[model samples]
Target: MIKKIFLAIIILISLTNSVNASTTSNYAEPVQTISKTYTEGFYKFDNKNDVDIGVTLITNTPTKIMILDENMNVQFISLIPYNTKFYLRNIAPKKIIAIIGDGEVALSFDKI
Candidate 1:
């Protein structure tokens, strides 16, 4: 009886670990993000190479955005009109920074 109970416990622990591993693997791994509010009427998101960044203007203000590389070279630029829910998709990750022109914004890193 004692041997059977010990064996059962071992099997249970193994099954638990397997289940946990599968559950963890079934989901996409989350990336670390630095979320901040740039209410200074300007914003910048440091884009990581190979990881696209998403920029959404949260306020009803006409704003222009620019994407730059690590060396301050411009990669892409756009303007978000007022009262519009702006979204940028599939933008290639840059080496340096992204800039917002005079607006409050919510930003995130998009999966590549």
Candidate 2:
């Protein structure tokens, strides 16, 4: 009876540990990239998932990037210079928009 009880407890503990390990593991979606060229205007993108995402912005000309919430409030903004690369990590926003003041610009967005 004693050996049976000890074996049962060990099995229960192992099962609990395995369950926790599986649940605590982190799983992220595959990276998605969007590239475009635009004149003196803005482009918007929808953020389907509310989870934190990483953004990589590459621009050929000076540009402005803004992340807004559902109410159109700016959550994040940055000015990237010509021929530069920018990165934003762990940001969860409702929308993303990029603006160009003058001339044409080439940019790309990497969602991770």
Cα-based lDDT for every prediction? 0.49, 0.46
Q: Which candidate leads in TM-score?
A: 1
Q: Estimate each model's TM-score.
A: 0.48, 0.45
Q: For model 2, what is the C-alpha lDDT against the true structure?
A: 0.46
Sliding window of 10 residues with minimal summed lDDT for model 1? 37-46
Question: For model 2, what is the alpha-carbon lDDT of residue 19?
Answer: 46
lDDT of 1: 0.49
Off by over 4 Å in 2: 1-33, 50-62, 91-93
Question: Which residue pairs collide, candidate 2?
Answer: none
Model 1 pairs whose backbones collide: 69-96, 70-96
